[model samples]
Target: MLSDVFGDPATIDETAHLVGEVRLIRTVSRAEAQRTTRFVRHGRA
Candidate 1:
């Protein structure tokens, strides 16, 4: 189960995995979010 592999909340490895998953989702949702919200793009550009 991908969620089981990535959703454990007690290990650093699991936290890192979950963060990566969250980043991917955030990147995908940025466009939609942009339609109604403003965001600051910071970091290596």
Candidate 2:
């Protein structure tokens, strides 16, 4: 899964811990990547 906006290290770590295995890549824009990906977080912080 990917995020729409910027994803900080803490956020990535949290996700990784929950999912058990996750890799986060920082990107300026989706257009920069070949495959489209965006992450929208839940209401619970």
Candidate 3:
């Protein structure tokens, strides 16, 4: 669960509440992050 593109704290909290958990991390590139997240999300990583 990434939060950088989530925008605000309230939105983050709302997402967490609905989605169960959320985590934030620093990445050099948005594309890289998206790729990693997508991989993990599909349980293929």
Best by lDDT: 3
Model 3 per-residue lDDT tens digits across residues 1-45: 456789888998897776553222233466678999999999988
Q: Kindly list the per-residue Cα lDDT of model 2 for residues 1-45, writing each as its tens digit.
A: 355443787787687676653223333344435333322233322
Which ten contiguous residues of candidate 3 have the minimum total lDDT?
19-28
Top-down lDDT ranking: 3, 1, 2
TM-score of 2: 0.31
Candidate 2 regions off by >4 Å? 1-6, 21-45
Best by TM-score: 1
Error of 2 at 27 (Å): 32
Error in Å for residue 33 of model 2: 40
TM-score of each: 0.45, 0.31, 0.35
Q: In model 1, which residue pairs have backbone atoms overlapping below 3 Å?
A: none
Better of 1 and 3 by TM-score: 1
Candidate 1 Cα misplacement greater than 4 A, ranges: 1-10, 32-45
